[model samples]
Target: MGTYLITGIGRGIGQELTRILLSRGDRVIGTVRDPGQVPAEWEAFVKNGRLELLKLDVRDEASIADAASRVNEPVDVLINNAGIIGPDRQSTLNMDFEGFLDTLRVNTLGPLRVVQAFLPQLRRSPQAKIVTISSRMGSLSYAKSDRIAYRASKAAVNKVMQGLATDLAVDGIAAIAVHPGWVQTDMGGSGADISVQQSAAGLVKLVDRLTLKETGGFFDWQGDAIPF
Candidate 1:
């Protein structure tokens, strides 16, 4: 089984993805801002060395680098799943500028930081892939104006991932952005269309099918192509 590195495994899609991968015999290296936040049920995996948790805050480059340094083994896949919904007062006309900047810091720049710090381990693998969990709201085709900060951050990250796909092609690494669907999580709320289980499962299947040909593309949780 492949070694999968995932960010923000404290809950939601990240946690589910870790669980699925571990159950299938793949080793999981998960990152969390607080180690205490991890579920106790994963103790078995942790004890068996199938799951390893790293302390990292994506917004902090030093922390990301430290975390990356701890993993010497090749990482076959890296999933950038940590993100924020942004501030409550986000809008085009009225915005929380500080919050908007922070949103961009975490959502847009965070993935790049993690990827750069972990490039060595990724390069060690014969086939390496990077998947960023972006949102459909980031799609330029959609003109919705709500939550502008969050939307802008996702859009920016998508562009960054596309560029990464291009630059890393010579290294034989594939990178792409994916919309995990409106999952029913703390962030997506109860009224969301899909459950975290469904979204995580679909995402794993999609990742399994990914190849160099699909690099730099945007796709949904259901594996459908999406306009960026």
Candidate 2:
């Protein structure tokens, strides 16, 4: 079974991904900002050695480095899922600069930092994949400006993922950004279209079929390509 390292698995999509992976007998190394608050359902997996939880905060470099240092096994897949919705004051005409900066730090740069810290373990894998949980709201082609800070951060991250795909090609490490559809979560709200279960299921399927050919492309939860 392949070993997958997922960030922010305390709840929402990341937590669901962990559930699916662990149920299928795959090893999962999940990261969360608070380890003590992890789900009680996961106690069995943690005791079985099939699941490992690392305390990490995407905004903290020291935490990411410390988490990476603890993982000695090769990670077949790395899912950068930790992100923020950004401050409420995000807008084109008016913005919270500090909050915007924090958004960029977590949503855009956090994944890259985690990848750099975990490169050694990724390289040890026979075939490695890096998946960043991006959003369609970030698409430049969309031309929508609401919540500009969040959009801009996602847009910038999409570019970063493309560059990573290019640079990591020689190493046979596939990196791609995925747009998880609007789902009913704390961020997506109750009015959202899909459920976490559906999104997570599709994401796992898409990630399983990923190859170098699809490394630079952006895709939806259903495996359909999206314009970045």
Candidate lDDT values, in order: 0.97, 0.96
lDDT by residue for model 2 (1-228), tens: 899999999999999999999999999999999898678989999999999999999999999999999999899999999999999999888999999999999999999999999999999998999999999999988988999999999999999999999999999999999999999999999999999999999999999999999998999999999998
Q: Which candidate leads the pack in lDDT?
A: 1
Model 1 collision count:
0
Model 2 residue pairs with clashes: none
What ranges in model 2 sit over 4 Å off? none
Q: Please give the lDDT score for candidate 2.
A: 0.96
Which residue pairs show collisions in model 1? none
Worst 10 residues of 2 by lDDT: 32-41
Task: For candidate 2, report its TM-score.
Answer: 0.99
Q: After superposition, which runs of candidate 1 have C-alpha atoms over 4 Å from their true positions?
A: none
